[model samples]
Target chain A: MGRFHRHTDGTVHEHEHPDVRHDVGDHTGYRESGTVRVEVLENLLAENDRVAAANRLDLERAGVRCVNLMSSPGAGKTTLLRRTITALSGTLQLGVLEGDIATSLDADELASLGAPVSLVNTSAGFGGECHLDAVMVRSGLGRLALSDLDLLVVENVGNLVCPAEFDVGEDARAMVYAVTEGEEKPLKYPVMFRAADVIVVNKVDLLPHLDFRMDRFLGHLRDVNPHARVIHASARTGEGVDEWCAWLLHVHGTPTQRG
Target chain B: MCQAIVDTVTAHASGRQVRRVTVRIGHLRQVVPDSLSFAWEVLTEGTELAGSELVVEHVPAVVECAACGERTTLDWPVLVCAACGAVDVRLVSGEEFQIASMDVAEEVP
Candidate 1:
């Protein structure tokens, strides 16, 4: 159906293979030993792996545990953070980086709680910025007192999908989804919930008032990530805060609140 | 070219009310497709790219050996042939970074 070329005796030989014959010297560097060719199939993710390695090293060196918290806008992320800060303030010196498209409200809330919080206001709306990368996190980290903090929680711009894909040199990725968001959230955003090390079903205090069903919500979460631990809590009330705090301590290997 | 594609796609995305988008970036450029995908996911949410899908088509380079008449396709740049371990080879194809496709859906009215 198309024109191609190849070599033939006395006649124009149509192209048999458009694929170029590789030079044995540099292209392959393949040393053929008794008909056996061996070349390592290195993944393109090598760069990300290298950066991740460096990030892990950086986190270890700082002696600061970083938590990347993701959730929907009104999923009670700030509320949960507020609750956590209040509970952990006396024990752990916590710092935060609040990412928002164009607002300082989240940072203001944290600051009011007497926690060190920095605001990252992105103009992604103009150029179409998607997610925060390691570079952005590093810049925000530079603004914080990395030496003095026991934990640095990066509250990503609320939206479950994109925040899950980024690696901000955090010790672990956690998610806080409010019960009011609906039970089908985990099913729709399986990738995000699956990526999380732990899932917090916040605003349990509203269970009696809202039509939210816990069984279905939890079932979807388990189907998505069988290993991810779930925490039920209300940032407004003091219920389940101790269990959440205990889990944090166990994960970070400190006492009650520091972890 | 890169900015143009991004801008066009972003505009297309905003018009359709896409929350997130995935693009398959072939295995050629230094751009880690994950970074772009991650960027696409976060940057789009709450606006137009809220739930858009990004599927990066990573085209692996194919190589053919001149000495042993060996041919193979691979995802990464493997200079030596895994079959014959010959140094003499040619890259048959690769070095392409294109949107394999886009994932789009109608916005709720």
Candidate 2:
């Protein structure tokens, strides 16, 4: 018998067994058995998780806090980073691990900000991988001197899906959600929203011209992740960038117990 | 994810011919079964594990309510309790993503 749990009504709910197929095999009496069952119980993402844990340990040992920033394409992640870099200039030592599918476009933009920036391009893969996994971040760390930085912001590839699924050994996860992406985004992409520790609702400066409802969007976000710290900002207008920088300072100051 | 599975299967099989690969995937992982199967086929093609059956056992997301102490199997992605409607609920089991086992041909002496 597999694992069983009791409901509030006293009914025992037996966990579904994948081995049921063997008992319900074809009634036709035919047995060609030369195979043995090998128990290889392991998480499929163990490799990635292991690498992420190692990366976290290395970062922590070097006394650096890392944050993974994610968002959809054109959601102003780069712009927010630019604003944040400017706002936190000289206040804290910072470095950026800019991840992109191809090209050095975003890296070039951040390089001009006078901060150490390492670019990790995944264009070698088939059409380039959508997200930056732990291995990629580990490789990017090679070019960066972790001891010199107080915080490392990994600007993940512009992807809301796969980026949330992969842990890049960051102390926290922040995402940029633009108001132009529609109010139903939180409901549609619950996983990404739920994974974020901080969510920045960017492009609030365009609120007067767009038909986007902030209330509905926030309501959906609340439904998906009530605990996420949300900040309404406009990377273009330099609005709410201070609060974002404050949060970064907070993360940098706090001793992270995460691995 | 498929690539991960393939790498795991290859490492575990170790000179043996795999017949079936069984994996337990949680609903919260948001992996589509059909897409995983297709990816498995594509990834395993021309490899040692080619033609092996990939069995995906979906695990439903279940949360234990903190206030009411009721375990609710969630149909949706919302983390609220079904009985008490409380948002403070601890997830019991839904984030699982593992390779449970595999059926491999016995070694020829």
Per-residue C-alpha lDDT of model 1 across residues A99-200, encoded as one tens digit per residue: 877768889989999988877776543333445556566667768777787887888887876666556677888888888899988767765786798888
Backbone clashes for every candidate come to: 56, 0
Off by over 4 Å in 1: A1-53, A124-130, A256-259, B1-109
Best by TM-score: 2
lDDT of 2 by residue, A1-259 (tens): 4554443433232333424434455634334334566767889888999999999999999999999999999999999998888878888888999999999989999889987999999886534899999999999999998899999999999987889899989999999999989999888788999999999999999999999999888988988798999999999999989888888888888432331
Worst 10 residues of 2 chain B by lDDT: B100-109
Error in Å for residue A164 of model 1: 0.9
Q: Could you give candidate 2's per-residue lDDT for residues B1-88 as a string of tens digits?
A: 8998999888877777788999999988879999999999998899888899999999999999989999999988888999989999
Q: Top DockQ: which candidate number?
A: 2
How well does candidate 1 score on lDDT at residue B105? Answer: 36
What does DockQ come to for candidate 2? Answer: 0.45
Q: If you score just chain A, what TM-score does every candidate get? A: 0.77, 0.85
Question: Stretches of candidate 2 above 4 Å error?
Answer: A1-32, A125-127, A254-259
